[model samples]
Target: MNATPLVLAVLHPRVALFELGIAAELFGLARPELGVPWYRFETLVAGEAAAQAVGSLRLTSDGDMDAIDRADLIVIPGWSTDAAPPPAELCDALQRADARGARFMSICSGAFLLGHAGLLNGRRATTHWRHCERFAALFPQVRLDPDVLYVDEGRILTAAGSAAGIDAGLHLIAQDYGSAIANRVAQRMLVTPHRDGGQRQFIPAAYPQRRSQRFDAVLAWAEAHIAEPLSVATLARRATMSERSFLRRFQDATGLTPMSWLSQLRIGRARAMLESGDAQLEAIATACGYGSPESLRAAFRREVGLSPAAYRQRFRMRNAPGAAAITPP
Candidate 1:
């Protein structure tokens, strides 16, 4: 990796100021005390000279598309609109950068711009959870992992909602420097050093949509037996109802079909085991009712957008927080 990577942030009209601030603070500021060469960051206006942003604030980029063209990494701090296509000039510049092996990153809705530039096609990416519907609908080809805090696909990286931008930035720093440097940076920023990107963006919470009557017993029973074959017929039988009635009530009660609910529960359980323990895939697969490791991988990919091993590698709990911290010999 280049020692002093040049980072350019593309700022557009009505751009998100908070997200832009994250990149600027993390990369634009000089940190000679870091004991390593840090990023050389600049802001390039995407479409206009002055951007009218939230809270009636206005911002102007110090540079232009030419700066972006010369950058080693470009950051887009979320887009203002889901419907409007990105400016032609910006798209061309991004394509040029990609061709030259320059990395691109986006915070929150900025993924929309990458989608418009045809950069996220077939790539796993994410934006804020609130706007996932619009994002997924617009770019179906982009495998939008709506649950993750961010996605790092080698050259192209993306972050989730507002604060997740910080996580994404620290992750890049860790990759370039080492975790000790990242931890020091985080200390200065007053934030956690590493919140694994694989963690769910939103926790499963009780909602008003669930059925009024408590199905605690059924849920508990299912949790204990999650490793077993969980067919709708079997679940319905346990609930003492016919399959048709069970399907209807389950949908009304949980807002998910029996099979879908089971799949989610199974994945959640498997994820817990993966994150907390070093159990082998075969054991986890059988315990999680996957029956085979191949089946487990497919399900893990579909639900989590990561294979079991990959998820464990990225998110598994450790004995020490500074495990990745670099040491000088």
Candidate 2:
């Protein structure tokens, strides 16, 4: 990687402003307090010098297709799914970028542009849930995972929808820097720091958060006591309901069962610990209620698609104490 990577955001016609905003907020804005080399970001339009955007807004692009040759990472914000195919020139530039090993990322409908470039032929990718059917039909060879917030196939990354762009952008930040830096960026943005990419985009919440006070309290209590061995009976007692009733209500409030929710919470905590500290696997496992390092490794791999050790190695803070002495599991 370059000392200061250049991130070029491609702004095609009728680009969704929110997705583009996500790219700019994440990579374009300067962060002086981060004390690290930040990305050099530019917005490029395919054709004209000025473009019309949603909400009757006009934007003068910073660069053109020629900028792609100098970019280390390229971002395609939401594209027009119904509009004509991207210009042949734009597609050719993307193909060249791919051949030279530049990373590509798409937000929501932007995956359509990638598909038009023939970049997602056999790779795993995703888009907004609303467009999954059409995207799958349009490109049957692409392994479409509609459930995930984002899919990171290494070189090509795709986000689900509007807000999911934030998650994917932070993920890229985590990749370029580390999870600690990503979490700091997310804190500045007032958003949750590290939502795993494999987490489901849609949760079947029969009662929306505004209407689920009792549900919220239960969730808070469970999270506060995440290190304890929790079960249906214990949670049922806390909620003052029968086990079956609590289970049904919990399933309705969250799309996951009691145990599944607890497991995800434990894994999330374990991930935070690994990213911010230099604790050993055995200690991290015990603190996260996994009982042993082997158990933690098994659950971490099953849920996160990477072992705890690997995740720590990939995302651990660089300046942490004892970081140099810790060996991989």
Candidate 3:
């Protein structure tokens, strides 16, 4: 029998409980029937033997720094943003494990610990947006990307904040097991299977719709007439404003240019059509205003990084409830 992979979660002082919980939920669960070998998870606490979480919740670990050397994957949960540097022993252990090919990952502010250990130098990483500035200032060599939810640079990974940790963990599972198994795990956890890591962290919860009532009306009209060759001039004429003024206001309200927003909408529609498996590529392209199948392919490849046929193959729900036309890639 093959040995199960041992995932060691190294807990730092004042670790965020929620980040630790996510690791435990994903790695600690035993699902042998899923056709994947079991994973052995051990929580290792550093410094003072025991640690207290946010609400004075004390956690005692059965393992210590030694576990890092034997781990197949090392997970650093969130650490205190205000705390001093990590100890030399922890840093050395991490460096040794990394040298020996053990994967290292961080969730939220735990990225600071990895940064301090010199593991993130010259790598693209992210933390909670609130701490991104400080993280960059502290580790100038590391390329800090604050806008995205997470970043995966093969062996090293970093996530943004609370819920983003879940996305990062699910991505790791997807890399270890195929998408189908990852989707099954996500279903069991009641979470979205895949959220592109590059998606914006916060999309402005309240978009102040009342302030842009006229713009909203114009947007609705544009959506209704996607097939029509609508231009900025046409939209400005409909709103009874100069083209320049309309362009500026549209960007300020939507954070995207009119053509860019239209392309996104068209691609969204194209994706739905591909998943439905009923519409031909050329028909879907015309319906979504791409004018031709070649245009749709170009737009889909640019936006989604995959052709429409590939996207359908990866995401279409096979054995969908309703009996729809099933087109094989």
TM-score of 3: 0.62
Candidates' C-alpha lDDT: 0.82, 0.83, 0.81
Encode model 2's per-residue lDDT on 42-122: one tens digit a residue. Answer: 988777787688678888876967899989999999877764788899999999999999999999999999998999999
Residues 64-154 of candidate 1 have per-residue lDDT tens digits of 7789778999999878645888888889989899989999889988899999989999999998888888999999999998888889999
Per-residue lDDT tens digits of candidate 3, residues 155-260?
A: 9989888778888888888888778888888999998987642423142112223246768788788879987788989999988999999899888877788788
What's the distance in Å from true for residue 321, model 1?
Answer: 30
In terms of TM-score, which candidate is stronger, 1 or 2? 1
**lDDT assessment of candidate 2:** 0.83
Best by lDDT: 2
Error of 1 at 260 (Å): 6.4
RMSD to the true structure for each prediction, in A, is 8.9, 11.7, 8.3
Please give each candidate's TM-score.
0.67, 0.61, 0.62
Which sections of candidate 3 miss by over 4 Å?
Answer: 1-3, 196-329
Give the candidate order by descending lDDT. Answer: 2, 1, 3
**For model 2, where is the 10-residue window of minimal lDDT?**
201-210
Model 2 misplacement above 4 A: 196-329
